[model samples]
Target: MFTRNGVWAIISKDKIKDFFHRFKSFHIIVFFVIFAVGVLPCFILSRGIVANYESRAIEQRIVNIKTQCEIIINQMGMSEYLDEPSSEVINAQLTQLANFYDGRIMVIDKDYNIVKDTFSMNTGKTIVSEEVINCFKGIENSRYDKVNNYIEQAVCIEHSVTKKIIGVMLISVSTDSIVDSIDILMTKAYILQLALSLAIVVVAFYVSRRLSRPFAKISDDIAEMSEGFLNEEISVKSYREMELIVKSINKMINRMKVLDNSRQEFVSNVSHELKTPITSMKVLADSLLMQEEAPVELYKEFMTDIVEEIDRESKIIEDLLSLVKMDKTSQNLNIMPVNLNELLELILKRLQPIAAKRNIELLFESFRPVTAEIDDVKITLVISNLVENAIKYNVDNGWVHVSLNADHKFFYVTVEDSGIGIPKKSQEYIFERFYRVDKSHSREIGGTGLGLAITRNAVLLHRGTIKVSSEENKGTTFTVRIPLSYIAS
Candidate 1:
């Protein structure tokens, strides 16, 4: 039952609301600026121009009427009409002038008696108004009534020869013509202003759209990326700010992709690692179960193998839990001041037995006394992993060196070992979770492949850096640098 206009109105309202919701900021600013700078000023200027025109028109009308009054005054004086009060020539002139201007005229003698009336309504009457009295004293006066649309002027008539006042001439003229012209001008100006306002609105909308288009594109790109469609970078180059935003967003997306891939790989590796141990344990269990009356020594051997597999599985799970905990503890570092030399000594002491079992000599040398603010437990884990790996990978009778040095800002620890070193290409990926240069060797050595990764995360959490240098058959050295003081960000 709706009319076409009503339906259109509803649709238009909905569209406006949608636009406001989408680009409210830019639209609000653009509309306000256009109205304040364009439409509002145009309206004020139009009103000012109309007012000036009306003022000039009123002045011109007053001048024309005064000129006619002066001409009539001269004629009346020369023909002695003011004294006689019955001159047909002067009265006819006055009546014609009044009729032409759609007004009335009156001629008053020195004693304030009306000598001639253009309308013939106040003849033979004595007038005692202020304007007439002031006119007799040689003062000319005028008054304009805008609401009534009229103007009145009072002038003194002088004797032509003696230059003495003889009578007062008062002319009252209608201002309807001037007012009508002004009204017409204002109407046209208002129409023009309305047209300009519409144009301004169009321009404002266009400007707002252009300004907001880049952000809209960015939003779309982000949405696509969220839906796993991030094969390329966002290329919104309309503005410098948009370019920066796009670059930052693209970087973040790339990082997220890398993390996602790493996560997938880590999960697969965990399953494989856990399954291998469980498989071994199952085989060992089956071997014992199949032999009902197995020898005590044989049973003990099988049980030991099963316990070893269980231990390996437990180690893998524990490392995974440690990695998860480290990820969560990135921001919550329990920082305290500790002696770096003492901390390294303690780690080496704990790892000395493992190194001795492999006949690897453990040596520690402190170049300078060093104290730094760090998380004690995490730092201990980092150093322990490094020194332990060095010891584990060392040859028999090989030496492992642990050294510490310090400067004004930072302290350094170097752990070097005469061990089978990593490949040059593999060094870059050593800190990646579950990465191993030789899977069989790693298994034989009982490495979970999560040690270096945990070490790197712990060092990074303390705002430190660790670097590794190695050769194929020579040795590997890990250098660690940590700041002397903890500065929380």
Candidate 2:
């Protein structure tokens, strides 16, 4: 449904976009900049100088010829050249002046009668014209006719004693030499401009290529890395900006290498964990099958062991599923304004029975009535996991304290427990999936080791932070901060 103008506009826009995409290169940009900076001023200056020379040359020549005409007119007034009409001295002077300038002169007396002509064709002729008429009225006049390439001047002749207008001298001088000189100058200027432009092009090409060479090499290296060569580093150190780019890209490469290794380890760990329970179930089944007449109580006990192994396998799979869901939450968040105080109280109430079994105390405190924008289910899971972990890992009769507070921008949740705290060496990795500080103790407590990882991921999805400070055999504190307003990524 596009109008004609709209279709043409789209076509022109696409053409311009395609042109820029094809020619988008540092070398092309630099080359144009250098050529512009170096050559445009030189061109303008050469044209200006040529034009100025043409004008000044014509003007000076006219002034010189006019001075000569004035002197000759004065000489005629002092002598009888106009009356006699054949004075040899004045006639020779006029002829010499005309020959020197390659021009014509006409001396016209009062009453519009031509007394003498240098070319001799207009002698004794009546010549009435604008310049001649104005000159007789005591006003001098001169003009340049560029199209005809000549200078015309009209001067008044006055008697020496009377100072009255007696005659007029009309001078027409050729400016052909000045034009010829200008033509030669224009040719030379154009030649100079062409040579300068050529030099600028050469220098622009060389410099732009030199500057862009390192980026080309870096691009090749990055292309290689994209094909599973992440271990290699890009080593371009030509310019300061190049060094900074290399540093940033190398850091990203290191992070990518770490991520790849983590993925490999995760796959290995999953296979081993999944196989262990199946192997145990097979061993128990083999033992039961080997007995020819196994007792009912013994079969029940063996079957119980198998059921526990299956439950363990199922738990591991469930936790893995939870982790996978946490990883893909970009579009799955059911965000709403949730009251932090009530959410924390409900989590503590739910975990209270588990804590009671351990003879551990569960407590909740609210510094202020806190509310924030968050996914209620995810945040509920996060708090439940932290409090439950605190209870499971704590000492008998130990107290687990949960506190909620808020500021103008964010709400804070703190869980402090008198638990067998994590060792400093293992603290950094506590949030990694399936990682355990004390593997044997973790198994005894039936921990799947995905709780903290899930908690951390959920917090991150809400653009929040979680930190832990622990001293072994003393106590541990986990602090979480989340903004009151949800900002989607």
Candidate 3:
């Protein structure tokens, strides 16, 4: 039986496996860089140092041997040794030098006869070689054979009094001791390289984990958000890059949440607005059917009320359709240059009778002639909605003023009305769909509550701004500024 803790352990192991699998390529690249930069260089440098050390050691030994040969030649006096060859002191010195170097030494006279041999085997023999010949001609020479592990040196035996070469001293020494010393150094170097390689591997693993940890956290947070756990923000701020990613993700989440809430509110508002009229018509129809002996006037009045409800329902649906069309993100605009003054005049002409019903004055003032690129149908609807609302909500005998003007880059329209203005707090949400400042008054005036929403969306589509200034119970003013050209982005 698996417990909760055991199940969580399995999930954690799976996450770890996924993390490594995702970053396997990165980890491999990091390891390769560490080996190339740290281990490979160390190995090459150590090998070069060992070879150099061996070479220098051999040169120093050769120098010492050459000095000893010169001293012996001076003590014996090259002419005297060549004539007699019987100096016990010089012989003893040659023997001691050969033993110290662990090799053979021979002294040859000008006639190529071995006058002295430290090994005692080549004594009284004739020695001929290129090194010895070169030495006698005043050219010193040395040879080191790495494969055979030996060094051979030839130095001239010059007489101290005459300072002239007479014979040659040949020394051949085994390089086994130098080779042994190098072997020790190479072994130590190999051990050091192994330790350094291990360190590099450890550091590579640590750095890779630290760098990938933020991505892993982001992945987990996104997964949790997908599972409907989005009440909290993603807070991964380990690195600068991660901080930017987290901030962007949080902003997207907020936008999605707002859209979701707006969608729910819109649906609820649509249901209520549609149901109210149908219910009213149903009540009126039931009343007519209940009165079997009703008079002609009563029947006509009930039928008129039902017809009015149907018309109100129809208006709401038409406004809803307009809003839905405006809400489409990819809707195309039928853009054209429109005369702003004429458009306002036509809108005022249509609303004149409605203003006349309340004895309110409808006026239009044009500061300058203006033409602008706009979607005619949508913009007409926007202007009409604002003016219609102004007339509908105005006090009796109050004035509704519509004005038009133009600037270098933009055209402006203002709609001011002597009406019951919106509350300060309600003005902020006036453009929201189905929002009403006075719900009972809105119903009495047959307001659909979608007029300002449609107006705002239309203005925004034209790359314009709308601002409302109002004080409750005094009046309201709406100013619109739109660009002269339509540039599709």
Candidate 4:
């Protein structure tokens, strides 16, 4: 394609394909246009120049011939035999002139009668026409004609000296010299044109290669990037637009690196989290069966505990699946205003009996109502996990406190417990899936380590934030802050 200023534009492969498929070979048609624009004019100009050059050369040759004939006529008229000459003498002179000039020469008398003929005087040969007879009345006539399909010409001149006409001399000129000159010029033009065309083709090929190189590099780099080669960087020596593309690609590669790290952390944490419940269920089952004389009521309690463990396992599996779904696809959210106080109240109520069995007091303290736009199910999961963890990890006679507060733009919730706190270093890793600050303690307390990670993901889905404040042996508090306006709905 050509721009308004006459610069050629590179055609993309998809565009070329589209042209062939829908627009009937549009790019191919443009190839001819380029040839016409760049090459045809050169050929046309060369032809005109060669034609003018040949014309000048032929004109110079004609002038030279006329000069030679005038010099010869001056010499002939100044001779003593100018008035009358014998047939033998005239024939001999004509023959000598014909041999010297590489042509046929004839002398005509003043009466327009042929006195000496160069060719044989034979019957059934080319005859002198009325035009030749009339030529005696004219000064001169010269032109080229085809005789026997070969180039030949006649040049007739009235021989004169000092304004006195003597006779007419006719010369049969050979056009071989002119034809040879034209042929040489035409051959040179063809050779020059061929060289120029080859140069253009070579330059065009180099330009096409240079233009396509960057795109080829980009394609290879992207293919590697997609295959999880996050460190792959694109390097393209190209124009500004291509550089911009490389910059964008580098940014995407950095993002993929972060995502890959997050994914690995998530997988590691989930595996450790799921292993806890499975180990607990196995140990508890073994312990219950080892009693030779187990009480019927105790066996029933153990069976109920096993059922609860199975339910917890099922919930963990469901949560894992939900996370996978959210990661891989886009889904519509069920958004609504969820009252943080009410939600926490329900979660605490559900966990109270468990806390009571452990001799841990469950407490609630909230003066302000907290409401935010959220997905109710995911929000419930976040609150429920926090409360469950607080109860499970509490000290004997220790208290678990829940609080709520809100502002015009945000709502905040906190869950605090008197339990062994996370270390400063371990707190940073707490929200990573399957991460455990105290793995043995978590297993003993029937804790699946995925609780905090799942809570974080749920809060993130609501465009919210979560933070932990804790010190070893000083207890821990989990705070969740969510925006009031941006809800899943």
Which one wins on lDDT? 2
Query: 1 or 4: which has the higher TM-score?
Result: 1
Could you tell which candidate, 2 or 3, scores higher by TM-score? 3
The TM-score values for the models, in the order shown, are 0.83, 0.81, 0.82, 0.56
Better of 2 and 4 by TM-score: 2
Residue 4 in model 2: lDDT? 88
lDDT of 3 by residue, 1-489 (tens): 569889999999999999988656655666667668877888899989998999899999888777877777677664487657777777778888888888888888888999888888887899889998898889999999899988999888778788788888888888899999999999999999999989988887787667777878888999999998767888997889779989999999999989999899899999999999899989988988898998999989988988989999999999999998987843689999998888889988988999999999999999999999999889999999999989887899999999998889999999999998889999999999999988998998999999999999999998899999999779999999999998686
Candidate 3: global Cα-lDDT?
0.88
lDDT of each: 0.88, 0.89, 0.88, 0.70
Number of the predicted model whose TM-score against the real structure is largest = 1
Q: What is the lDDT of residue 236 in candidate 1?
A: 85
Q: Spell out the clash pairs found in candidate 2.
A: none
Question: How many residue pairs clash (N, CA or C atoms closer than 3 angstroms) in each of the candidate models, in the order given?
Answer: 0, 0, 0, 4
Ranking of candidates on TM-score, top first: 1, 3, 2, 4
Candidate 1, superposed: residue stretches over 4 Å from native: 1-23, 28-38, 124-139, 191-211, 224-232, 283-304, 330-340
**lDDT tens per residue, model 2, 444-481:** 78788889998999999999999999998888999999
lDDT for model 2, please. 0.89
* Candidate 3 clashing pairs, residues 3+ apart or interchain: none
